[model samples]
Target: MTAPDLEQRADHIVEQIDRFVADGKRVVLSSSFQTQSLPLLHLVSRSRGVTVYFLDTGYHFPETLEFRDQVTEQLGLDVVSLHSATTKAAQVGPHGHLLFAEDPDYCCYLNKTAPMETVAAASDIWISGVRRDQSETRRQLDEFVVRSDGTTRYHPMLDWTEPMIADYQERHDLPRHPLDDRGYVSIGCAPCTRNIPGSDRGGRWFGMEKTECGLHVDLVR
Candidate 1:
């Protein structure tokens, strides 16, 4: 879709969110505060009372954590921080040291997905910043979806492109993730993430085939 088209779609999405809020639905936004996440964060910030969920995986770069806090404070967001039941040290006891290297998927399940499942159990709507252009796995996702758990998963920026995101951030003066300046396009857990050229998600899970952290994939199940 063109930039104009995506902007129109974004407007419609905000309207839908407003309507959901008016109807007293429990709406929440899940954000990673990555390079492309600011636009969606800005969008949801405009709607009062929508709680933003940030998965505190305990392994994220210090820069990411700082940026998350900056965005929360700057936007005055109603943010809810989520963390795994197991501590990193405790997880290592059972899964072995460097569990992310041994089994990234399972590690993600423990840290990311499990916390989100708890959030999904209580939320009626889940707003996310996922865009089709980010990865092949996300390309097939619909802008609006009904999860198996009965929560409505809404992707307000599903049709957006990198240029659109840059434009929106510039227009709104939204803060960029600090790691983005260092060429880290897709920021996540520090150990599993790196700098890769061209692709936005190329840095994620570096050598492995894993693209998504289980949060997006498992939330529907």
Candidate 2:
């Protein structure tokens, strides 16, 4: 998309957000604090009372934590950090290895998805940075979707491509995640992520068949 096109989309997003706020709907945003997350982070910063939630799964790279803190401080974002109720030591399997090695889905549920469920249940709108160009699963998502629990999953940047994201980040002079320079495009937990050569979400979940960590699919009712 061209710069003018992106600008138009951004304007529409602002209007939509304003309408939601006007309706007195509780608005919340969840971010993974990656480079791709910057555009939405910056956009939502313009709106007041939009609390950004970061699920601290206790498995993120040190750089990711630093990046989250950096962006929150720089943008003055009202970020709330959520952590799993389960202790890291208790995330182990019967064999004493991490549950991610045995059952990644269950591991994600306990760590990432479960912690966000309560917040999503109470909020009227949940803004996401999920882009169509990121993954096959995300490509099927619409700009606005009401989940089973009545919380609307809003994807304002759903149509944005890789180039558009890069252009926007450059235009805003955004601070990138430290791992972005090393080809970690779609970052997640350190053990599940890898250095893929492209901008898409191929780096996430690595060799596993799973794509999403279940925030988009299972976090709602």
- The most accurate candidate by TM-score is 2
Summed backbone clashes in each candidate are 0, 0
lDDT agreement with native, every candidate: 0.82, 0.87
The stretch of ten residues in a row with the least summed lDDT in candidate 1 is: 90-99
After superposing candidate 1, which stretches have Cα over 4 Å from the reference? 1-7, 93-95, 218-221
How well is each residue in 81-192 modelled by candidate 2, as lDDT tens digits? 9999998888998888898888889899998889988899999999988887776777788878888789998888888888888898998899999987787778889999
Kindly report which residue pairs in candidate 1 clash with one another.
none
lDDT by residue for model 1 (30-120), tens: 8888868888888787789699988888888999888888988998898878898987776763546767867778788888888988888
- Where model 2 places Cα greater than 4 Å from the true spot, the runs are 218-221
Query: For model 2, what is the error of residue 179's alpha carbon versus the real structure, in angstroms, after optimal superposition?
Result: 1.1
lDDT of 2 at 124: 100
Model 2 Cα shift for residue 215 (angstroms): 1.0
RMSD to truth, every model: 2.1, 1.9
Alpha-carbon lDDT of model 2? 0.87
